[model samples]
Target chain A: MKINLKVWRQKNNKAKGELKDYKVDHVSPDMSFLEMFDVLNEDLITKGDDPIAFDHDCREGICGSCSMHINGRPHGPLAGVTTCQLHMRSFKDGDTIVVEPWRAGAFPVNKDLSVDRSAFDRIIAAGGFISVNTGNAQDANNLPIGKEAADEAFMSAACIGCGACVAACKNASAMLFVSAKVSQLSLLPQGQPEAKMRVMAMVNQMDAEGFGSCTNTGACSAECPKGIDLSNIARMNREFFSANLTGK
Target chain B: MNWISTFLKSSIGKKLLMGLTGLFLCTFLIVHLSGNLQLLKHDGGLAFNTYAVFMTTNPLIKFVSYGLYAIILFHAFWGLYLVMENKKARPVQYASYNGNANSNWSSRWMGVLGTIILAFLILHMWNFWAQYKFGTTPYTQYERNLATGKVTFSPFTGEIAGKMEKFVDTERNVEITQVKDLYAIVADGFKAWWLVIIYVISMAALSFHLVHGFSSAFQTLGVNHKKYNALIKNIGVWLFGIIIPILFAIMPIYFLLLN
Candidate 1:
């Protein structure tokens, strides 16, 4: 198959970037989207041209690192899948695919399609943790978490910190991402000690990092490579409200 | 009010504000809608006007009414600040970004719909509040005692309206109702097609704002657990998307169609 790629290129965060078009032939329909890009990179190296740079660590959709606004969506026109997991079969021969970095105030381009997602890291560092002492794991009977509570905790824990949620948000909000982190940690006994302060601190860090407020568009879930639900956001709200109301 | 406190600028802080204010506004909608419901009655209903005047005149009621204004200003301004910051941070714009309008119109047009609602609010006050506060209603000659030559006003004829039910309800734990000529003002204002058209647009804008506002409010407040998040959105659709339009549409529809 032959395909046209318009890729975003930037030398660094401070540099101005634009889309440069490249044409590829002999692309396999069965190839992963990233693999097709690998073919392009090979051609770039052979021709002494700088290859397109995008983020992808674990190609398995769990890591949100393969974050990009592919063809106007968080992950290329496909729903509920990440860029790395996408296949060339979704498109036809001679198709023109546009690729760009996640465009948000909190996320800036680091190279080509790779944006600095350290803002999310900063938010996590600001709070997203349990204050439990490091040791052999506590006895499971120390805390009898109900099945419902345990399930909810696991569900919230599913957030991959991928910038896909932010890319997917209409307001460029990190709320779904932040809320998931808060909800997951806040639900468990290990996270109970500093739950209030943790939620507050992480949320403060998220805002300070310049992420927009979540306006509940739920695009984050739809575009999510992992099907993280929007309910984590609501739980975060309940948690945050309780935190503010009573240290009692 | 620590200027740089994490609570004030924190993401959760912002969400709390959004949630608290969103909840307040939601309550206000019920009140406003209920008042409008009275418009379904004949002569566009005196029950609505009697309540408006009672609210503005009563001391405690007036205090709460002022609080409602403050909430509106805070929500609008804070939202603007966040939106402007987001604009500065974004790098690329899509050729066609309508990928997510399916969720809610309010979510999509936060700024535009909010502005429309604000404009409608200003016009509403100017047309109704100003008249009730300062303008003189014509004192009417009523059915009177012929022998005594004294006036006896008729309630149904719009000569002398009774107090709103809420004000007089023993179950209500308040001193006064804001109801007054505001109800009459509301009725007379909607009687004008142009004014009714503006009112309808504003209601539509409110619905749009609400659709997104309701959902966004939850997200901001950190309501992102998978089990309950969809519930909030579903409720948002029913509340903002369906109910609000019904309430707003009913008034204009009644005036235009029935009147």
Candidate 2:
């Protein structure tokens, strides 16, 4: 299959970027989207041209490293899958795939389709964790958690820190991402001690990072590669409200 | 007080403001629509005009009306400010953004729909509220027989007076009341096809706005529970979005076609 690609290219974070067209022939339908990009990059390298650069680690979906806005969606047309998991067969032969990096003031483009997502790191650093001193791994049954709470917490914990929600939101809001992080901890008994502070600090950091406010559009969860629910945001709102109300 | 200011300044706090103001506005819509439905009564503007008089003159309602006005302005301006900040968050936009793929069009285009509603609000207030308060809204004299309870109305071309005047005539067993005829103005305003068209279009925009806004307000206020979400979404999509807007639209269309 021959695939037409309009890939964004930039020299560096400060450089202006534009969509440069490239055509890759002899592409297999089973090749992953990133693998197809690798083919295109090999051709570009063979022709002594600069290859397009993007982020991808652990070609599997869990790493959340592959960040590409394929045809306006975070992970191409398919839901609940990262770009690395998106196969070429999702498109027809001669399909013009428009790939761009996450466009947010918080996530500045580094080079081509790769972006600097350290804003997420800064937010997480603010308070996205429990501060218990670790000695050794505890027995799983030592902490008694309800099945529902455990399931919900695990669901929230599935967030891989991908900036897909930010990329998908029209406002570029990080609420879903922040909320998922908040919920992952707040729902667990281990995360109960610093729950209020965690929510307040993380939310403040998210605001300071220049991300927009959530409008409850559900776009983030809809385009989320991990299917992170919007309910996490509502839970965060509840936590923030309760935390502030309690003045704790 | 300091904590209050801090909360209001935060992003979630700003969203809370939007949610509070939006839900308040939604409440006002229900009240406003319920009152406006009096215009459709067969009483020849008597019921609607009296209701309008009570709405404007009653001290408690008047106070609430003032708050309503302030809330509307705050909601509109704050929403626009948030939208500006949202735009600034994405200084560079996607070259090919298909927002429809993930979100509803109403959710994506809320600012635009809200702007349209604001413009319509200005026109509506000018046509009705301002006209009733300052401009020349003609009055009507209503005479009701005390025995038969039958009422009759005629345009009062007499001297300018207060909002309402009432007197009972013992000889004819009739009660005469003269009041400012706001309903007449409303009905007459809707007679213009262009105005009715504007109204219908504005109501359509209102419907789309409320469809997303009602449920969105709940989500922002931390009300998204599995138990109540279906109810909230239904009220958002049905009551505020479809029923209220359609009912409001029917008023202008009714006046234009039937009245």
Candidate 3:
């Protein structure tokens, strides 16, 4: 199959970017989206053209590094999956795919289709974990958590920090990303000690990062590759309200 | 003192303010719609005129009216601020854009819907609320007996034969209810087809605004419960979005055609 690509190109973070056109031929229907791009990159390199730049790791969708806004969606056309997981078959022959980076003040363009997501890292560092004493690992059965609570915690923990939620949001809000981390720890007993401080600090950092507020459009969860529930955001709100009310 | 500034400055806090003011407005919509719906009553506007007078003159409601005005202004300005900030967040535009795949049309275009509703509100207030509050209105008085609960009014009688002060009901006794002819104002306004059309279109815009804004406010405030979240979302879509707007639309139509 033949595909026409309109991809964003920039020299670096300081440079202005524009959509540059390219054509790729003889693509396999079974090729992953990134693999299809790899073929195009190979063609560009051989022709002595500056190769396009994008971020990817583990091309299997787990790394959360393959960030691209394809056809105005984060992670391509498919829902509940990452761009790396999106296959070429999702597009038809002669389709002109538009590719761009995650556009947000918080996530500045590092190059073509790659933005600095270290904002997420700083938010996590603010208060994303428990500060329990270091010791040998405990048995999985030692905690004896209820099934429902354990399952919810595990589900919240599924977020891979992809920043797709921010990219997909009209407001470019990072509430989904922050909520996932806040929900994951707040649901478990081990995550209880620092629950109050965790929400306050994380939310403060998220605000400091200049990310937009969550309007509960559900687009973040709908586009989330791991299907991270929007309930996590609600949980974060509950945590923040109580913490501030009690002066925690 | 520090917490107040932090809450005001923080993104979530700003959203919380939006939610609180939004819910307050939702409550106002229900009450306002209920009062307005009384225009359809066939009692020669007696019931509606009475209710309108009560709403306008009650001391408590008057105080609450001031708060209501403040909240409406706050909600509008705060929402504008958020929209401007979101626009600044994305400096570049997509070459080819299609957002319908992941989100609903109303969710994506809330800012537009809100602006339309705001425009409609200004026109509506100028036509109805401002006229009611400050404009000269036609008024009439009825005669009543304090002891017998008997009331009397006549289109023929220009003035009462007896002193109206003697019939005053200080403690649950019968008395005349002096009210503005607001019913006539509304009934007269609906006679215009263009005004009716504009009202119907505005109600439609309001419906779309409530569709996303209702549940979104709750979510912004973190009022989520596992079991009740779905129910809250459904109410936001169905009750506030569809039912209330339809009920409001019925008023002008009823006045124009039936009344």
* Most lDDT-accurate candidate: 2
Per-candidate TM equals 0.82, 0.98, 0.92
Q: Across residues A93-178, which tens digit of lDDT does each residue of candidate 1 receive?
A: 99988887888878888999898899999989998877667889988798888898899888878778888888867768887788
Candidate 2 per-residue lDDT over residues B128-196, each given as its tens digit: 999999998889999989999899999998875579888999999999889999988888888899999
Checking candidate 2 for backbone clashes, the offending pairs are none
Q: After aligning candidate 2 to the native by TM-score, how far in Å is the CA of A50 from where it should be? A: 1.2
| CA displacement after TM-score superposition, residue A30 of candidate 3 (Å) | 1.1
**Candidate 1 lDDT by residue in tens digits, B17-131:** 7677977888888887776677675532344555555666698978988999999888778767766766665556654354553254456667778778777878877886678
Q: Model 3 off-target regions past 4 Å?
A: B140-178
The residue pairs found clashing in candidate 3 are A81-A225
Q: Looking at model 2 chain B, which ten-residue stretch has the lowest summed lDDT?
A: B157-166
Highest TM-score among the candidates is held by which one?
A: 2
Grade the docking of candidate 1: acceptable
TM-score of chain A of 2: 0.98
Per-residue alpha-carbon lDDT of model 3 for A92-201, expressed as tens digits?
Answer: 99999999999888999998988999999999999998987679988889888999998999999999999999998888899999999999999999999899999999
Q: Write one digit per residue (lDDT tens) for candidate 3, span B84-184.
A: 98777667766665678888889888878888888888899898888887875555555566787466643323443321213466676667655566777
lDDT of 2 by residue, A130-175 (tens): 8867799888899899999999999999999888999999999999
Model 3, position A77: C-alpha lDDT score: 89
Q: Candidates' lDDT values, in order?
A: 0.73, 0.93, 0.85
